[model samples]
Target: MRRNVRVAAYAVCVRDGRILLARWTGAGGPRRWTLPGGGMEHGEDPYGTVVREVEEETGYQVEPVALLGVESARRVIPRRGWRRSAVDHQAVRVMYEVRITGGELRSEVDGSTDLAAWHKLSSVGLLTRVPYVDTALRLWRDRPPTGRAMGSP
Candidate 1:
């Protein structure tokens, strides 16, 4: 079995009763919303990854106030409809209840996100949000330990 692991960070930026989210355009043309963050660079700290990704994707600087949780997932990728490979992505995301330190919200033209906006937390389910949103929220609500148990498979 071929395996790959990836670490990423996401920010749960809440401000004025709203949460910051990014609309992502998927390869299948579907739009999905998610928190402002992304993958970690080699040897980069998870906290730094979120801060950097938030700025890059949302044009806003955020400071990580707390670590919400970590999550992982595994899937099989089919190559040309026959050959397949198992891929595992483990994200040690340090979700922070962030406040915008600076910069205006803008879409990253040359980045993973296409649009950035603030939405009421209550209305998040009404929009097309990535699965991670729910997971992150649950973790935030529960406030799991920094090195607590692993997420469900």
Candidate 2:
């Protein structure tokens, strides 16, 4: 198996009892709601990455207020084509609490996410979403002093 690692940043923007989410259309899976952020560019700071991703996905300029926590997940993906080996995938996600600074709400065009919208925090579970959404929210709500989610390594 081949090992693959990805590090990405995400923002949890909450206002008026709602959370901002972008509908991810990548990964060739069903579209699902996720935080408005993504992988960093080469040599890019995670702080800059979160700001850039949020703007690209949701048309909002955001300023990260605090570093909430970091979460890591690992999984195995079987080979998809001939001569390819199974992949041991690990994702290191950095979560931040951000506040919107400017820009109108709009969907990204020809990007990984198609739609951006605000959903009530209480009703988030009713929608189809990526697991990252919940994990990130927990980090935001819990705000553990250690900067790690409860029970997380």
Candidate 2 C-alpha error for residue 135, in Å: 0.9
lDDT for 31 (candidate 1): 82
Q: What residue runs in model 2 are displaced by over 4 Å at the alpha carbon? A: none
- TM-score of each prediction: 0.85, 0.97
Scanning candidate 2 in windows of ten residues, the lowest lDDT window is 144-153
- List, residue by residue over 6-60, the lDDT tens digit for candidate 1: 7788898877768899988776668899988888899999888999998988889
Error of 2 at 9 (Å): 0.4
| Tens-digit per-residue lDDT, 24-93, candidate 2 | 9967889999999999888999999999999999999999999998899999988877899999999999
Candidate of highest TM-score: 2
Cand. 2 Cα-lDDT: 0.94
lDDT of each: 0.78, 0.94
Model 1: residues with Cα > 4 Å off, grouped in runs: 81-92, 146-153
